[model samples]
Target: MEATETVLCSLLAVDLTDYCYRVCSRCQRVLPSDNNGLASSSFCNFCKSKEPKLLYRILMSIATDTSVKTVICFDRAATVLFGCSADEFFHFTKLNPLAASMVNQVFDGEMLRMTLTRPHNRNAQHMRVTSIVPLRSGFQPAIVTLTHICTKNASLGNCSTTNHTLRKGRAVVLDDPNEETQTALVADPNQEKSQKKGMILPFKPLTMTFHNVNYYVDMPKEMRSQGVPETRLQLLSNVSGVFSPGVLTALVGSSGAGKTTLMDVLAGRKTGGYTEGDIRISGHPNEQTFARISGYVEQNDIHSPQVTVEESLWFSASLCLPKEISKEQKKVGMDEFYLIWLRYG
Candidate 1:
């Protein structure tokens, strides 16, 4: 009965009550706990080490159109689902008590691609989730989701004070009860003004210049057999261009004129061809850093037809922007992008 299967399913529910377990660090066996539910200091007969480590083990329900299954996931697959290591997530949950609920909220109804393994025994009760991958491009990590939840909760006047002790045995205070209300009462004029003017992206203006750019690919064997002496077929030759900031640049050419090839070389998207050129970004030689500042869309790129334009923009902003940015700011950026598209697209 040993079989493995892959399926596309929606995560219906998660149970976090017993989401983790303590294991012997050396032998990786389940460790016993005392009456208070704390790890015991008893010696391990397997490896004779007393150290214990926590590992994530999650129980979740996944469903397709008709059938549903209960799956057990170990640490590696659990990390992929939560987007953080087990120890880190444990510490985060301790610091923010709302994190567990927030995680469930974020993952509820999320689509996932999962690999499931059936046990060799015919009477096994649950399938094992060997791997997990989020199908949504805008999937947020557990920490990010928790932070957003905490911020939203605070804004809604649901803050509380808690005292915590650090690993160094120092006492720390978190979230004064009056802090949120006091901050809400006082508004920053500069922030308001900036909001009215719309958010500015954190990017400096850059210009790209290329001179004598040429591209070549290996000549096919069929052509070489036909008595062609050259071993390489040149696609572009001595092409020069400059694209400045805040300018519209268009490459116009008939089919087979190498317009797409030239753009691919400039954008560093060519995978199998040899390129020769002096391509510079703002007077500096173009390197891997160019990928961080530039974007290229292929002619055959496709998106989900079921998703609307606004939904696509929001998803892109959520995925591409740094986690430090607030959800409100992301919404604002999405609105701005929608307006630009309406005007130019």
Candidate 2:
């Protein structure tokens, strides 16, 4: 029989505390560890293997904005989010203490969208975190206002000028509580008329480009002390690529071929790596805005085991779709179209 499932969307109100786990050296099954956080130096009866390897097991307590908190016991979600197995995470932390510290900073004050499962005959629950999206506390209103103005200005044809003027007017109204904001948003009809009369071009497709990219990370002191000339290890060298709109690209390579390193560099996700090169979108350098507009999925199965298929669709639609769309329209699009197709198609 299948297990029951539950889905939770909440702020990670506390830190993700990690514990040491022991696994059989050969078979890789979890084993009991001693107080030193090391597994017994004896043979493992489960796999008849000798010795045990230490791994990192992550756990966290999460709460909604209302302060309803629950302690989540992690299974695969931690592995997916960390981009490595527990054993690999432990080893990586050991080798790169700086990188480990940088990673720890990602947890506090992030929004967690996770899925949980409950077995039929047991009280224990399991969880998988599908996403960890960082929320900048005070930036939403400004971002929404800018996006509205940009959309109005970029749309082609007869309505563009009127729409832009109206949006600017609305901005002035909404921003009236702040005197400086009101002054900044006051529309200029003269400028709008001049811009409209000159030229109006259709929206252009965005193309992301990276040229002659190189990335390196600091090497461990032990390696440098052992007479290694370079204190920094180069992960990628002279990589060049272009990703045009509507084109599908794949980065494929064997283990340690720097595929992930190159991707991380282009996505602006690498914090501990030393990078040098041009990464641009539509002739502009990539920035935090790139991260806001692009989505990257890690190679892990992350979904709420308890959420119904329809509930999952609703969850995404409500959070991801444009707020300008009416609630009725959004529901119709989901229930009448996307949900139906997903069920029968």
In the predicted model 2, the residue pairs found to clash are: 5-306, 6-306
Which candidate's TM-score is highest?
1
Please state the error at residue 186 of candidate 2 in Å.
Answer: 34
Residue pairs in candidate 1 whose N, alpha carbon or C atoms collide under 3 angstroms: none
Q: Tens digit of lDDT per residue, candidate 1, span 1-345?
A: 568989876665566655566788787666766888676765676788878876666678665433555788777786777656655666666666665544554454566789998777744568888888887665644555455445545555553223322111111112334454211110234543544464333334455667778899999999999999999999999887666444576889766899988988888889897999777664457997688878888886356889997777777677667889999989887778778888999
Candidate 2 has a TM-score of 0.30
Best by lDDT: 1
lDDT of 2 by residue, 115-142 (tens): 5544454534434343343233321212
lDDT of 1 at 123: 48
**True-vs-predicted CA distance for residue 129, candidate 2, Å:** 51
Query: What is the RMSD of candidate 2?
Result: 29.9
Give each prediction's root-mean-square deviation over alpha carbons: 22.3, 29.9
Per-candidate local distance difference test: 0.66, 0.53
Error of 1 at 125 (Å): 3.7
Per-model TM against the reference: 0.38, 0.30
Over 4 Å off in model 1, which ranges?
Answer: 22-52, 87-91, 94-97, 121-124, 155-345
Residue-level lDDT for 242 in candidate 2: 60
